[model samples]
Target chain A: METSSPRPRAERARQVADVLRQRITAGAFDDGPLPDEHTLGTQLGATRNAVREALGLLRAEGLVERRQGVGTLVVHPKYGHGLDRLVGLAEALDGYGDVVNEVRSVGIVTPPPATAERLGLVPGAPAVHLERLRRLGGVPLSLDTTYLTADIGVPLLDHDLAGRDLFALIEETSGRRLGRADVVVHAVTAGPDTAALLDVAPGTAVFALDRLTHLDDGRPVDAETLHIRADRLTLRATLHRGPA
Target chain B: METSSPRPRAERARQVADVLRQRITAGAFDDGPLPDEHTLGTQLGATRNAVREALGLLRAEGLVERRQGVGTLVVHPKYGHGLDRLVGLAEALDGYGDVVNEVRSVGIVTPPPATAERLGLVPGAPAVHLERLRRLGGVPLSLDTTYLTADIGVPLLDHDLAGRDLFALIEETSGRRLGRADVVVHAVTAGPDTAALLDVAPGTAVFALDRLTHLDDGRPVDAETLHIRADRLTLRATLHRGPA
Candidate 1:
């Protein structure tokens, strides 16, 4: 196991902070404010100073807030989206809230060479391009841009897009079962336009995902780029160790 | 398909940019500066203005540079780490460079409540805590903090910690095969101390990963938190759509 530096005082505080963070995310404090520092210290078997430092760490992480007279309160924790399975945003966020799609545009255009190659289309072939701003409970969550081979994409233009996931529409239009996807995730600072669309400050950190979805027979069918609010979502996965 | 807003000019520019980005990443220009805008425009069947805007967009993405009297050049691209597999840092980064572990500390300590629970230990049980600063090609990449069950962890104290991965060491020490891990990934701004250690500016974006590893019999054994440099790594995964 790889380890961190062993500064005793800081380590104690980090451990305390870790415990508190888990508690906050688990809704241990959802019903009310966190206990006083001394009380937390006694419960966690840490010193008052350590508990204070722990709270400071949580505050810096945007997990908690200290009010003038209200004490420490847990902030809304981020939702976890599983990465192990291929699911649409609405399916992944089921039970959270209704996901509404604001369709920005839909048209046929010649895709860039790389996109054409990914979709196995001729270099200059036309493809359907779509863009949407997605919201969860009215708060902007992501800006999604998608490209599909014209055969399936053209039919989608006439379908209802505001209340359904593209994955479902693609399957329905093409009558082919979707199988797998290749995804890449990284972090980038939001640009001016993306920031405005996501309702966040310019230069705010955002999660950028590039995905290529394929049919069950291994034909690549959809290419997508999504810029998501980093503060609102976390990616989760369960990975297995292959045989050595 | 859900599409993006269609301002034709901007869309053209973006399409051109996407083509250039693929070429750059594929090492088409690794040996020299990119061709002049006119040549690129002619080659891609795009207007000179669209090509110029595309170059500007690439410049903004830090993937290219417009030097004095020189054309655009590709910067170092981020390495892709597969998130679909449970692999150690060195294993995941094979063929990239040597991954060296700076074992900052290793000792037994009482784990935080959450970590203890994850590792299937009593709340106040002692566990082996280890901290390491991992570097790839001598550049700091991640700071890993780990807690392990003492039975297997205590025996690891005498093993060579710097040159090998903990997964291998654990398997050797405990005579048990590793199974799977649950991981959660999010983005955060680097704190002052972490920034100093990772040699990045404070408030720079970082990827934070929390993971719990289990044995073949489904006993959780290791808990870890890792902070990674976002600029240096992109997480990749192949996901399958299960039966609806």
Candidate 2:
């Protein structure tokens, strides 16, 4: 007579679990009420203890669940969201009312290192700067900073910036209508400056969107960075399998 | 006597900026060397003082740059990476040699309410649980936890999990092939559990990818959450012009 080697308690449990895992994944065992411990043990030709141990292993893997009185059951599948689209946050909250943007500060200053390179500017050219704290119904959401060339709108800083739309103001004042833009998004935590501006807890998680707008001729003209709360915003993107 | 109202310093700069912005965005001013302050001021018939103030505003907005002793320049547009794709990190690093995955534990348990709903799992069922820390070149890159249906893989715990591909193993063991998946990406600070597993500093900024995979038949198979180093990884995605 052939005999299988005696297995340790843990090993026995593992052996039984392997068999059960195969059956469930193979679709032989659909997601529904499972056989009782005795029947499963007898069917697999293993002890009830071994069957129980195997079931324990499955539970931890987020695969199965066991109710107090009810038998074990199976779970269906799920889907997740994408992050590539250049959608606007304002658009994301289109239905939500009471959206208000609080103007933090609006002034002119020099460009930072990365910003200067992106804007195709001289190391020392004059530019117009605007900063604001965006809020929805008094709840702070994001901190935005925008830059424009001085030659384009020399008197831009004197506008009623707190109430006016920037792109519209640029069109009216400079005669340069708003066009398309390119954007970059990244995961980031709130730095001291952003934390203070957004009034969030220090070291909280945040999402950052960096964008550069261009004219119809494709010349880069403006740059803006929007820093926002991560939890409050849900970034979604959909991709097509076909050609770009 | 015809007299024009004297413009404030801020207002004068803004006006100068509007003309320059219009010209630049219209491509009349390519992202190239600018005319000298005296020349530009004379051509615009504006005082150099007002021009300089306007330039200052643009610099702060990151639209233009003032290199040390160099002239102003325009910046290039930046691109953003989205988290909505259903790509696997292990697959992302396939160019590297064999990776070592240390299986921390496996057990049966119930998922949190949110996770349960996301996975489409019943309130009570057997969930297979697995925790692993992923490493690259001996350095920890991510820590992940996955949950699946126990009934799909009864003897799952005893499988040769170490160094085994979960997807491959599932196909071979359960005959369930994955067709598509949905995912969510977010920025977060390392918590205690994540810090300990990935060996990262607590409160360090990290990107989190939460995902759910489905079979070709549209059955949800597994749900996973991955915590990765934010600075070390750059997420990328491509988008076309138009709605999905």
On TM-score, the leading prediction is: 1
Q: How does model 1 score by TM-score?
A: 0.86
**Residues A64-171 of candidate 1: C-alpha lDDT, one tens digit per residue:** 789889999876657778999999999899999999999887788887666788799987899988888899989888888888998878998889888999998888
lDDT of 1 by residue, B161-231 (tens): 89888998899889999899998887766656666777877666677788889888889888888878876
DockQ for all models: 0.48, 0.11
What's the CA RMSD of model 2 in angstroms?
Answer: 15.0
Please list the C-alpha lDDT of all candidates, in the order they appear: 0.79, 0.57
Candidate 2: tens digits of C-alpha lDDT, residues B157-208: 7686667657656766876556566655556666544555667666655656
Q: Give the poorly placed runs of model 2, Cα more than 4 Å off.
A: A1-84, A107-110, A121-128, A148-189, A212-222, A238-244, B1-84, B94-99, B107-116, B150-180, B238-244
Judge candidate 1 at residue B242 and give its lDDT: 76
Model 2: how far residue B2 lies from native, Å: 30
